[model samples]
Target: MNTPPSPLEAERTDGSSVRIGALVPLTRPGWAEAGRHLLAGLELAVREVNDTGGIVGRPLELVVRDSAADPTRAAAAVDELARLGVAAVAGEYHSVVARAAAARADALGLPFLCSSAVLDALTEQPTDWVARLAPPQSRGWQLYADFLLGAGHGRIAVAADSSVYWATGTRILRDHLAPRGGTVIELDMRALTPAAVCDELVEQGATALLLLVGYPDPAVSVVKAVRRDQRLAEVLLGAPAGQPEFAEWAALLGDDGAAVPFLRYLPERLSPLGTRVEKALRERLAEAPSFVAFEGYDTIAVLADVLRSHGTDRARTAASWASVAVDGTRGQIRFSRTPGISVWQWAWPSIQVVDRDPAEPDRFRVLHAG
Candidate 1:
């Protein structure tokens, strides 16, 4: 196996382009829609950076790799990028895959700024080599729980698939809800059909059903089945993992997809910088960009700032996480050691529980914020 370049060897040669390895899930089995939006944001930021004089006058290049939602593939890509001498790595929407990439990058002494993964335990132990922009699972899910309580939803059912991400989310919801007089009932997607899910919700008398499964398959089917069921007409549908943020959800489920609340990491109002980037991203994606796209854009924005301030030394970039204060599209981006979180975290980005309006279906309504 080939080894990664050491700190001294990873330094940029004068006049050579500076490379930032981009780990994105651009292919199938991945959330390709989210990946496209993420790539669009990252590409937009890179273009803006180069147009403004690049990083220290050497053009900043994004070396893209498709993570494809596979952890092993993501880890392999990290190794390949390290051998290719990227100064730092950025972008990944899947929490499990991001954890794998972060571990590999840490082992290789490569700095990685995770764009959108929210799993609280990003690494087994804290390290300066890794940092994240998205709010962690615990914080976001607890807020979702609070939203449920505030809305008079005391009994909640989670129809979740078998995955670390979903399992962690279920645990968070359960832990957070139990003490607050809220009850969480778990419905395993593996054993229950969509109709069965509806039956369970009715039997359990669940006031709200949260989709903790993947999109377009069980999640879409569950929503459809529940919507068609007369007994479930009044039950609230929620997707705290943000599956409804993309256009594909609407295009697939139409009205059925509306009013299903999900967590999104965008401010209620965009900053001036966020406003400009949202317009550009809309032009690039040809649709309203999701919060994932904003995350992708912000990832590059922070990385560019670091590379310019600390040079292309991986060690220096890793150390500079504590000092990052770039104006991201969402908010002022900064990193610090957050309690119970293993990686350097943004502490938060603005969080909202938003859903497409049933009245319009194209516009979003902010239901709750934290």
Candidate 2:
């Protein structure tokens, strides 16, 4: 395989054009539902760039890599993209993977911006080359906890993936809830033996449950366990990663009156930019896309602008990366002023369970801004 041009290589060449390689989970199993939204969003942004006028008179080119949600795979993808000479790159959600990708970019001195990964740790150690479009998960968790605690709830139960994302999320949730005088009961379903989660729930007598995991099976199992017991019925549900196919979750829970709320930065009610982009993407993809796909789309859209403005001066491109800002489908996204992980803005829109019928999985009313 040919190697991508290094900053030195690009420095020696003309400043007429630029290329942006986007690293994303294009073909990961169990995440296609989420990936589609990211892809759709990426394509939408690319289409917009090409349609009106190419960025800075140069068209944006998107190069894709599949991380498969594995750290090793994610690092490899970043290496490949860097080799392909992308002026700057962005990432998928799941902060662990994002951090790995950021590490790769840091080693290569390539500019990296994250659109979906929300963990605060990823951005806290920011580098010269990395930034993010969403606020850190630290902020996200604090916002979520404050909302719950402010709602007059005394007790909170957290069910999270044993995976990195959920693990990190649980830490932040604990930190946020501890000082608020709220009881935080956290359970990691990923590492537990069968029926352990159910037993734990029974033991805790939790009146409210917050889900921080995304692996569908265990999440469904937990909800089902909650539904099977009438005692858990009154528990209010909060899900940070539970919006895209909530009907499936409700069905698994037998719709037994468990109201699970999804906490996201962007609300379901599409903003003007979000609406226009969604319409354009649907026209291109021929269907409504998933949430993460839209994240990907927005990632590309803003990245294209960055490349256009810099015109292939890798160092200048990297330095000027902060200048590129647009009203994304998510919200006002700009690079972080911090050094390690650079996510500045985050919109926390709460998606709640409005109506659930197996017939309609996308049935969600924006309980709060997404």
Best by TM-score: 1
lDDT of 2 at 40: 62
* Model 2 Cα shift for residue 239 (angstroms): 1.7
Backbone clashes under 3 angstroms, per model: 0, 28
- For each candidate, what is the lDDT? 0.93, 0.63
Q: Candidate 1 — which pairs collide?
A: none
Residues 345-369 of candidate 1 have per-residue lDDT tens digits of: 9977989999999999999999999
RMSD of every candidate to native, in Å, equals 4.0, 5.4
Query: lDDT by residue for model 2 over 69-88, one digit each (tens)?
Result: 77788788888888888877
Estimated TM-score for each candidate: 0.96, 0.82
Cα lDDT for residue 266, candidate 1:
89
